[model samples]
Target: MTNATTDAMTDATADAPLGRSAVFTILTTGYTGSTGPGVAATVSYVHDGDRHVIVDPGMVASRDRILGPLAELGLGPDDITDVVLSHHHPDNTMNVGLFGRARVHDHKAIYENDQWTDRDAEGHELTPSLRLIRTPGHSREDITLLAGTTEGTIAFVGDLWWRPNGPVDDPVSPDRVTLRTSRLRVLAAADVIVPGHGGPFKADETAPV
Candidate 1:
């Protein structure tokens, strides 16, 4: 995952467009580089005016390495306000509970009552300024967040698409495919996109149109 916009078209969403000025440092980048081998995951961060969140923290394989980099930025897990998982895959959610007292903010598809559950496709309002968009294909729980307004809408898509070069992995479920296509239309109309695995991205690059 290089940048956000390069993530995917369908099965994704965006929320209010946050500015670079607000983003501070990567609490951690779980892993970088390509998959396989000694490569691990990378964790990144963004500052919503003092409210901090850490999206998709990688596995233990290399999560420790990311800590050093985050320290350089003068931040730790305790400093985070929320922990947002892209989806339910353990590669990203295995160590999710290790963080501080930040309440997890994920899509309703995978989010159970204090647990992760699977459900049919449906959209809901996550917060006052964000819309939780459901994008099934990748296990039905795959969801993308859409910001309230274009002024700073950032869609945090988790595993809807791969990094640098990858497409949304569609499933055989006709129902899910139908939902994915519809979500693509929404992606085409977003502003900023903060992907789960990659960095942040703008709207136009991956818009389905």
Candidate 2:
């Protein structure tokens, strides 16, 4: 990545709230692919009231990189009250042990452990402002979080769409049909999408210019 891109990633990272909650995305070089433009995964956090909810914390090695941005904003692991994994992938859910003070959440099918929360099959209402969405495809337990923001709805979807090497393509997942169904469901309501292996982009701007 260029210096400009790196700087943009840091500058645009944590420090503000998207809606009434403190939400931001942190990109780490934990898993960059050869053909991937910026194979960095996005680890997002939403501070709803006193609850600090982290979405897809990325690999275990990315803990510091993830915490660096949080520290800059005067936050830390103790501040994290919840950890929501979009799926059980190592890159997305490996750092669950880092947050001892937080509760882990994932799809019921993937998380049968007593420590982790596997809510209703239809998904759970995290808060009045935040809701969990089941968007299985990449994995049977894949999920997405919809945060009601002042700008509109922002969907934190893990691997719902990928732009390998900067080219937006229908990235391969476990099931194409289910992926398409999830995409359509999210597109119908999401204004912005925070993808797994890329940066954030406006949903409407995803169309060909």
What are the per-residue Cα lDDT tens digits for candidate 1 across 85-200?
66677666766765656656665543423765554324554345544556655555666655444354556665554342323443323355554553464456466555444555
Per-candidate Cα lDDT values, in order, are 0.52, 0.64
Flag regions of model 2 displaced more than 4 Å.
Answer: 1-22, 25-31, 34-39, 60-62, 109-118, 164-172, 205-209
Candidate 1 steric clashes:
23
Q: Give the TM-score of candidate 2.
A: 0.75
For residue 75, give model 1's deviation from the true position in Å.
2.5
CA displacement after TM-score superposition, residue 78 of candidate 2 (Å) = 1.1
* Model 1 TM-score on a 0 to 1 scale: 0.62
Model 1: CA > 4 A from native: 1-39, 109-131, 147-151, 168-179, 182-186, 199-202, 205-209
